[model samples]
Target: MAIALNTKLAEGVQKAAAEAGLAVVNGQESAGFNGIPTEKYTLALVSAPEGHTFTLELSAGFDITAANIAPAVRAYLLESAKRLTNPRPDVFVTLGGLPVSFTNWQWPFHLSVSGADTYVVHGGATLEDGKTAADQYLKAKVSASMTVTFAEVVAAPEQPFAEGFIYNAVRKILDQGQMELTKSGGNRQVVPVTTRYYSAKQGKFIFNDTTAQQRADYLLSKIYWLSGVLGGGAPVWIADPRDAQYLNTTVEELKKTAESLAGEGILKLDPKFEYASSTEPLMAHHAEYEHHLQDALDFTRPTFNEEMRAGHTNM
Candidate 1:
């Protein structure tokens, strides 16, 4: 079975190469009877440039099948195109006060065959050998030459706040019950709980059921506090005009501070703020809330709140 599959694969590759206007010849031939190649072939020849030509060998265990061979051949052709088009970059790393350079010229192309996944190997045993062989082959066939260069190291600027600060702040707000966290599952997975609030102001500013007037007051208080801490020019409110009652300072300064805090990773105060208008209404969004409550009941098995317990009794 294995030998037949191997033969079929070799024939498919040979046919595919022939159709692509390339001549492919078997590398391993039988010792007797007109030197015919063995069914378990080892090598092949393709028409390439004179001095740049290199051999590409694809080998598999005897259990290999024709389905396996087809994708391997396709991957080989694709890899060849990639090498010719966007040659891999050279990398440099520092170790012990010395700069070490390395080049990667080959990549593994994965394919699934007969419900089993397999990878097609490029070059020979090692990457260096593959690079040399591929470079030679490309040079002879297409006069292609690859350049070697040093890699640059880029350091990200340090942030002002600790890592996960925004995540922790959001989680803390959720825990405070400012918004509802409902979990629902589908598609063989549990979707992240949807965080819903009655108003967009609540969603963005992390406020509870405060009235719009109260929110405006709260904003003014925050601006004053921020101004004191930031050494008091006039207090600036970087809030939507519809939501703002007190605008003692220019919107430009508000935007400037917002941008600075966001860049320093201290806060994310941009378009997420614009999402305030789409806030879900309380009680009307009961289907999602019930789904989440049921999920909680099944998983945690905790005592229900009076409302939930009474509802269950009615049901």
Candidate 2:
């Protein structure tokens, strides 16, 4: 059977991958991200020849090409494996969400006491008593000095980002961005985490802290109010499909489930990257590179799931 996939799924997968790429570009860690950055994620397409039905599913923890993909994808996969050459029933696809895994946190802390006085200088007391006998100008002074000490607590950012939701939102943004690319070349390139640190201890802080903060703020701006302009973090735009309460289980499990469909022969996993860029934010344009990479994601994306699961609502 010739099936048409939903563009939303492709949109979700692509957005997620691009965001992953963004994390590496910004010199942030992507691995500890609850498996969103892992290579285990998968997308599957399954076929059911006997029933003349097709299925598409996303696995939780395994690769889409592996033998443990989701049930629906398995059906379509087997169907594709069978002898069906009329319309050449196999199709390739991808999707995305957003890019920035975490938003910009101001993380305000007092680096200096009133900031001006980073040090204290001890001043010796001046002696002013003179001419004690006949006519004298009386003056008394205490020989006391002042000592300066510095104190500050370790300061860092704390995020309230919902782990699964953040990933899901980014996936959607990237998936939408993917539709604009040509398979040959020109992808959203992410800077490696090895690039540079924007934090204060780098000693580079004296000159660039403001600049770094500005850059961080700029990228965050794109995801925030602007996201409303594009539709982000919304209940309808930011829920991960792996919600067992809503779907069946966790994304990790779903990934494995999605991967098994490949054994059944219909699913395919594409190692792809999503790159985000905007003409605005003159500062972010210069921070990471010549332009601002709003966010990026790398994933074993689901392309056919876009086709089969077209009826469901995205969040």
Candidate number of the best lDDT: 1
**lDDT tens per residue, model 2, 17-77:** 2332211011121221223321112222233223221222232232333233223333323
- Tell me the TM-score of model 2: 0.17
84-195, model 1: which lDDT tens digit per residue?
2111111111101111112221211212222333221111111111223433321100001111110001011001111111122222232332222222211111111112
TM-score of each: 0.20, 0.17
lDDT (C-alpha, whole model) for all candidates: 0.27, 0.24
Best by TM-score: 1
Off by over 4 Å in 1: 1-9, 19-21, 29-51, 60-65, 81-315
User: Model 1 misses residue 87 by how many Å?
Assistant: 10
Q: Model 1 residue 244 lDDT? A: 23
Report the error of model 1 at residue 115, Å: 28
